[model samples]
Target: MASTVSIGNGYGQLLRTRGAWTYLLPGFAARQPFAMLTISIVLLVQHTTGSYGAAGAVAAVTGVSMALFAPWSGRLADRHGQRAVLIPGVLGHTASGLTLTALALAHAPLWALFAAAVPTGASVPHIGPMVRARWGVTLKGSPLLTTAAAFESVTDELTFVVGPLLATALCTTVNPAAGLVTEASLTLLGGLLFAARKSTQPPVAAAGHARVEHASALRVPGVRVLIVAFLGIGSVFGGMQVSLAAFTESLGEPGLNGVLYGTFAAGNMLSGLVCGALAWRTAPQQRLVVGYGALALTASGLWAAHSVLVLAGLGLLVGMCIAPALITGYTLVESLVPAGARTEAFTWLTGAVALGQAAAVTAAGQLEDHLWGGSGFLVPMGGTLLALATLLALRSRLAVRPRSRTVARGVGHRVPVAVD
Candidate 1:
């Protein structure tokens, strides 16, 4: 009973945190469309063009566009505020989605489809970083900030789990256009709702603020190393996705792809919540190292599994390390960068993940096409090994000694004064 009460208190703390749900819910909703967008585009383009090659090309372009533009959007939010950036970004993104859908329905030329995809991808609002920046501001200097980061990680897992399933269902049953249209509608509604919550938004730094011109977060001691580590981690996800699809197809149950993928995400979501609830004795950097090592170990299990059931079970096991790594990674970024550039720093992390996933997916697809079953799974295992190596080699740069209470208090009390 005592343990039960403690668990309940953890949840209570999450709920009572001011404006937590208000910012998080819409952020969660908005991210679903992004999660849905790539798969929907692939399905839609394939259905119309009858060419998986065409579909893959368009999806790759979309992914690249979003990865390139996300940091720019985040930089604008850091300067102009989330509301200023998100509203226009979301609107343009929605408009682009609509245009793409219209083109698809009208049987427009393949070149036209690719052209519309550029803006649709480029206009994504960087919702992940925006919500996280809000949490950083609201929960600064509090232990609960770790929990909040974990919550966001869980939201990411859930979005990936649900979004693809929903997109697949809509594309297969209703129509390909239906999936894209739903993504657009959700983006508009969720973006507007998220933008409307101005009170929780982080205060923007003035244009002329000296700190706004501070050296890029990439210049921070361990940030570049962290980014590289995250890129490898992202490849783990991308490779697993493609590997699972190939694995399921070999089982003659291609439709079960969503189920298998969701199972992986479910493991991530569950582990994130549990990891967040516990008090950690280790520092964030240490936890991050452990997470990477564990991921590599678990991912290697894929080599032993020949059947779908065994593969799915191993996926769940591998997923357990994902959230802990991501939560620690984001928390480390927060500690490394100045407050003025937090959003952009976070978005860079997001973009790195996207690019890594894109690269891995492309490579994994080729391997699956040429090699025997389960061989493609080696890619993620290799990625996790690379991540572990990078983290260990650069571990010294990520260290953060605990601050004295007096210094912590003094730093916490400083207000954001405008600079000329």
Candidate 2:
């Protein structure tokens, strides 16, 4: 067992790895667009069309397209390579995003906006999952794998904090379309830089590992459970995006939207850092359950928050609960799925989150338009409670499988299995 004192040393070891910064920095830049997209679409469409429902509908289309296609892209990355998949994806996303921005600003009909959104979203490179796959190969059997998951979760939260703040500021102060425009520019530049780092990319599954490569990652029982749980997390995110904006607008303090959301994301980042630094005696499955329960409880109070102060406090608490759950869930992925299928498995979870967020955005936007912002808050609490019940009922399905990785033998492949 590692002592608490090992926290700094643990992360330090990962930082000290040769060429780590090459991929890490560009990967960080490439992922900002995901955090920026939904809010940017929501803000811009709402500004141009004067309807939250329409804005959410457009954003939902984008989210759904991304959700449907992410796993396919991941499978291709596994079969071919990350560079091949990311190059065209990055180019297509940049072009499509620019088109969507133009259409929105021109007040083209809703159908045109939705049409442009499809390609805009579907081309989003699953950079975060690809980065995690790289980390998996780089540190295969080390205890630092768990630390790496925590580190990635922290990086995700940091992007959320910065992305929203930047997008919101650009939309509010510069131009309504500024957020999406800047997002496309970053995708082009950062994605190309990341793709050029060929040395760090995970090798394509060799022909000898064909059996493992051909099998779908979804065949694992645990991956399905994690996907559903991640969907609930996505609901919280999507619900909060629309609700917080509506609430702040109602108060004539629209700028607070970024501040409040940033507070929430900051909480997530802080807790992720703490999770990485600790050495735990309990299993990740247990931690996932407990963390989710806390998330559900904190989320329940959001609808009753009538003041900004109260809402911010509750948001921070809810955010804090998320990292432990996310970190543990990703940690479990390492054990439940085989090496060749890890990228696809990660994309499945990512896609599930996107799908859930799309649904929540549509539902919450309708509630905000017809009822009130408070009504939108109900979505997160309800989604989490229902998912928590499902999780409890299906908890047994999340048991970690025996550890296995495909190793190349002379003419074939064999998996060296280890007991967890």
Q: Largest TM-score belongs to which candidate?
A: 2
> 179, model 2: CA deviation in Å?
0.4
- What TM-score fits each model? 0.87, 0.95
TM-score, candidate number 1: 0.87
Estimate candidate 2's alpha-carbon lDDT, on a 0 to 1 scale: 0.88
RMSD of 1: 5.1
RMSD of each: 5.1, 4.0
lDDT of 1: 0.77
lDDT of 2 by residue, 122-223 (tens): 998889899999999889888889889999999999998999999999999899999999999888988999999999999986777666564677767788
* Model 2: residues with Cα > 4 Å off, grouped in runs: 1-3, 403-420
lDDT of the candidates, in the order given: 0.77, 0.88
